[model samples]
Target: MQPKLPIQCPSCESSLSVTQLSCSNCSTSVSGNYTLPLLLQITEEEQNFILQFFLTSGSLKEMATQMGNSYPTVRNKLDDIINKINQLKTK
Candidate 1:
């Protein structure tokens, strides 16, 4: 049977290479450690907001309406989330 691909870090979408496994996938590579991006470390509320925005194909007007908030408010929240994600990449 074919083996499954290595697990990926939720934050960066990078593969997680473990050192070992009991099955035929043993002897995995042990390279640098994988760290989750700070954005992924953010509060669940923020993550959910971002997820919803993307699921709606980045429709800010729709997001604002669905969230019962002003356009500026939704825009600011999105900006904050983006800034946080950018910071993660810079690290």
Candidate 2:
């Protein structure tokens, strides 16, 4: 399996910057200091949550049912992810 893209420094727990990109087909590479997108800056779990939210047609009720969680619980999780994304946007 392929590894997940790391968004934080393992040592200091700081946000990490993307410094390289490559074209798999052409073997072309580019390198520079680049910040990860706000969504990508969040944890993978959060990303998946957002994706699932979209797949559920943005319905908390459906998400709650599918996740076997209470509606309030699912809503709170989404709120927390929104807050995290907002914070990342400000940085």
Strongest candidate by TM-score: 2
lDDT of 2 at 27: 98
**TM-score for all predictions?**
0.59, 0.94
Minimum summed lDDT over a 10-residue window in model 1 is located at 15-24
Q: In model 1, which residue pairs have backbone atoms overlapping below 3 Å?
A: none
Cα RMSD (Å) between model 1 and the true structure?
Answer: 8.1
Q: Please give the distance, in angstroms, between residue 48's alpha carbon in candidate 2 and its true position after superposition.
A: 1.1
Highest-scoring model, lDDT = 2
How does each model score on lDDT? 0.74, 0.93
| Model 1 lDDT per residue over 1-75, tens place | 986343466799764544433444665545455554454456678888988898889999999999899999999
The sequence of per-residue lDDT tens digits that candidate 2 reaches over residues 10-90 is 999998999999999999999999999888888888889899999999999999999999999999999999898888788
